[model samples]
Target: MATDQEPVLGIDLGTTNSACAVVRDGRASVVRRGDDRIIPSVVAAMSDGRWLVGTRAKKRRSVDPVNVIYSSKRLIGRRFGSAEVQEMRQRVPYRIVEGKNEAIMIEAGGKVVSAVEVAAHVLTYLRQMAEEALGRRVRRSVIAVPANFTDSQRSATRIAARLAGLDVIRVINEPTAAALAYGYIEDTDRVIAVYDFGGGTFDVTILQITRNVFEVLATSGEMFLGGDDIDEAILGLMVGAFEQQHGISLRDNPVALERLRAVAEQVKIQLSSQSGAAVHVEEVLPGQRSDLDFSLREADLRPYVDPIVRRTIPVCQDALRCAGLSPHQVDEIVLVGGTTRLPHVRSIVEETFGKKPQTSINPMSVVAVGAAIQGAALMGSLVPMADGGVSAPSAAASAVLLDVVPRSLGVHTLGGYVDFIIERNSAIPLEQTRFFTTTTDNQRFVRIQVCQGEDEVFENNLKLGELVLSGLRDAPRGEVTVAVTFEINADGLLEVRAMDKETGQQQVATMRVLGGLDDQEIEQMATRMASAGPGPSSRGGTVVSR
Candidate 1:
């Protein structure tokens, strides 16, 4: 068990990369090993039962396409048969399989590994990195996730942290964490928008900052829009050029596609600094004496990627509308995530917010720094940092975070419609209850269909699972009134409780979240990971330059 005396680490477990930070003596700084501040969220298996993580693992993608797993975050906490997973299947070279409860499992390293387990590998590597940098053992941490993450995704992230041997003290939204990192909390009230564009997801959040209180007013996002999509666009051009030259399509070749994907990412990164990037792939056609070469300038890429960048505009408009604010009302715009480094992306953000984005703090590490501030705040050691941030804060501390639910939570009702119990954007740690009566005479039980969405028709909304209220008092129809309460805690995890209205006694109430690992399975994977081997090769490897 971790005690309050232990230092808490703040982690940004991202889709393409991961970073960690901590607060010491009122200053929060991102922890780094030498010049490396962030590690690639990739893992690979060696033939000797050893696992390679981070940059080394990322480099293995071209040679070991099926065994090297990246972008697992998109599938984490998702069903294997979901549209998103199915869509991802077409892009990546790895194998996606269905696990128990339809949870997504990736076949890598000659064995099937759950997304949670793969994420745990990244978390474990991050933990080791933090411990090495801080020169101490830390077990408590605050994690940041995307604003659009559902109950299952958040739960799966927590389990990953548990497997990493760290106790999760809190989970904050990425955009919210970025806002805190900018130290936007001043005496006067101001509205700020966080445009977080990363490798595998994009999110836009509008928040109102008053003194030390950060309240999220509205948020909108797309899970599949980011740098990866841009890479895909570049890959498309490469595939077309290859087909034109060699009269062959590399689209169906996993190895060729993986190799092209790597070069495409490198080209994207290179074009950010240079006028044009030269992409060359040697021996692209198996053992043949063949090469695929190309050159791309920013202007050439703008056509293919501008559409992807513009997709975020409507999402921003939606968030601002939901927040009851206009573009002019926003006092400042803060950019977070690696994808924000692109000039085109920056230009788009400026056009949307009518202001230059904040660039003093590193976009890649800001969220982690803010999360560390929150962790220190929770431990009661928080102070206003030198940069744009307050320490990790406790709920009871002077610095408070007012987060909201991303979607509407409701129950199935008459006419197969949805009865929204808690509307979207409502503040957290709040509870709402609705009374239910039996429909049949001598009814002993009632099953409440719990869902999350704003659809008027029940079937159109997402089915989270059901809450059963049994052992009811046998009475005539409508005589027995059962009070069902839905409570969303600070973590945004749903909890249901039922009570007998007549007897004033608590009854059975449990919510079964779909497309996630159960408690026992989480424990089993944790144990298995413990014995998996020494995680993250200590041998030095090249770190990608951002």
Candidate 2:
């Protein structure tokens, strides 16, 4: 058990599964429930108006597909009109409807629920399990997210943590956390590449690790690519085979397709360690007694998996090129995520790195353990683990971590173009101030449109929101000057501030975010959750607030 007077927990909020860990007496360990170390990241609504999380909830995916929400991570913080959400609506058995401000809402349990609430329930469950295992009150945590998660996504995650009654002290990228978990413990100073292939996302990060400082050199990833896509590929094979064998298609039958989806996931897992796996489903057709039986060989499966695995190679190359290193230049490579267990995937990684990647550690829980180390470090108790691996004892005792902004932040300028304030890969907890002039005479306030991306064209970048800076002195065009400052914290959350250049007065910054909940909405939801006294209930936030 950890010896900290008040232990801080590190949580890996993964798409397929989640885990929590803590560092005690300088050794970081995962907080498990008996043998149930990993919790399925699924939530379901029972008929009695109660809720179920983890394994029980995941089991409901096929039985009560509509009431069960799996892969909600892919939908959270995304707009309803987005290509990803629209594609998901047609793919999943559950209903995804457009709520107020185009936010994605899930229709489950005969009522509508926001994606934030679904995530809160999952976070709540993770917190409860941590408290139970540690035998203490756990009020603070460090949550790990993907490297490329947007500002809105990060904000949504923090709100979820608050609703779960845990204060998120810090938010670190998954690959960065994994690197930390590996670096400070080993005491090695070298360049490393972290290939994180998770349930819903794929990312590659190159880092330069010093004795106690870790700096992210370059990072690139696909927002919607990973194990889920692999499952879909395998699922496609099963559907095609079943349709060919029984002369019936299961694609139109959602319930039947749901059953097949479960089988598809199981087959993928089974094939991970074996050369072949059998797929058997009884009564796979609607109102028809038809058994679908088939066996998939590793060689045969590779052809289907080839395309998905190939997509990651270019992404790796891109990161390496950006980092100004060759494939053979990196000192070491580490793989993170459950999806990395596939044999072919490992072989591809081996081919890329010119050596077999490290596999001794549990990829699923490694990120959480690393996060726990960071949590301990933040509390000023972290040091080299009891095993005694890291060197530079003095520097290791007080480690420092540095991260970079994933994408560029800018504002929409005249002629529908972008004027970048902070470029991509710039260090975080950073701020840049640029002065702007009024476009029209006697303009009392100027509306500054904030966006995120690298494109020079306004329409090409993502419009985060607009910040209104008021109380300006009236002046002629291009006369009154306003200084706008863009700040991104360590967690990559963006905040803007404006000031009058002439008088040096701080002006009010009113931001109207595009999709996710604002401060007031999140506060209201948190209050409701508190009143309910919380045992896995849902909350909803439909409107956008300023």
Candidate 3:
């Protein structure tokens, strides 16, 4: 369906697996690599100094436990000292070291690589696969992210796309994208709830769709919860069973643990379709002569997983409350992410909504399909459907999306109180300005301590970064008024600008995101990637060129 023009791709850069899709002839479908539609988001460093991506990389995890790096999504755009990164370091087999600017880095392939770089490799593989499937060059794309992603995380995702040589036209939220895929072409206007429980993160979003406009009323979720937790629960059960059988704990052995993790994931999938699954491992323990076999019934695993699935209920209820709507007010409940395939997950969702959730679309590919529709709509290439709505709209007509900021943004004052600039759930692509003056007489500069949270106490919130507005006129405390502007862009990334009221001059301030790479570092990595070209074994014998 693509002509000479380069096609735009919609990529779901997920934690457990990633996918891509495109729009053709007013319909959206997923792009596949040979017979495979989902690619594992794993990367491995070969002994020959080459990198392996996707399935090949995932296979190397058990063999080269120290070199294969998966779940880099959890580390991307995270501070080295943050609680999340510290937790990840303890769980993963690869080594995580602090890099410049306190960014999280991993030791792989005899080199120190930032989480951004590792993620870039996965993005590159997806880009190549899309191009090959379309039989044309693919550059522009719309990438999806969690609804609760912070400014640094959003910025880091954009940078990763750039490193992969893709021009990201927009970064849409995952739940919003799912809604678009589900109701974009429906003729009726209604309120829909999107429950996106993915591999690495979970997000619940409430949206009101009217004609061609989709407005996100409220969004909330746990950044650390998802299908990964289910896998972890099963892994723990296996670990206990193995230890009891062999009288030895395999937790200390990274290689054996990795092997068991793979089996646990498979069993988790099998249990979804069947009442029980048999998990068998041969030579699982060190120097073991016998095999370990165990029967895992759906009922036995439900105790561990049901509690985790129930955790999502409060988040969903909170989101509905934020939207000022009750559960019955919601017309349709759409499920997204692979974890939604679980029978218990669906049952709980139905009970919560008093309605059956829609699962006609493949949960794993819905987000990407929705993103492709958005991309096509943005590019003015979508053709209007025969119905009142559009399966795909023309270039002259595009749907309007109104998103909101997930958290409140403010600055720390002299009294250690937060001066709220932008409130949470405020419609995004918004700008607000507030004026502040120095507290001390003849103060030469003022410090702006930016933070993100609802806490009134400055220290209780997460510190985003700081800015020092210098070269101010040495006037009385209240006389030197400065106007500070806080802007949340369409992609939900924050930007601040300060100006002197009297001189009308923009103040020079340092804007450093706490867990993000600096311009210089990004540029250096771009240069290195360009010079190195594609890794020798990156494609697992599938030819890829720079």
Model 1 spans with C-alpha error above 4 angstroms: 1-5, 45-49, 211-213, 232-257, 274-305, 381-398, 537-546
Candidate 2 regions exceeding 4 Å error are 184-189, 210-213, 232-257, 274-304, 381-397, 475-479, 536-546
TM-score of 3: 0.87
Against the true structure, candidate 1 reaches a TM-score of 0.86
Q: Could you give candidate 2's per-residue lDDT for residues 360-457 as a string of tens digits?
A: 67888989988887887777634356676433333333666767788899898889999899988777789999998889999988898988877899
Compute the lDDT of residue 48 as modeled in candidate 3.
71
Q: What are the runs in model 3 whose C-alpha is more than 4 Å off?
A: 1-4, 184-189, 209-218, 232-254, 274-304, 321-324, 381-397, 439-443, 474-477, 535-546
Please, what is the TM-score per model? 0.86, 0.87, 0.87
Report lDDT per candidate. Answer: 0.84, 0.81, 0.83
Q: What C-alpha lDDT, on a 0 to 100 scale, does residue 409 get in candidate 1? A: 93
Q: Model 1, poorest ten-residue lDDT window?
A: 537-546
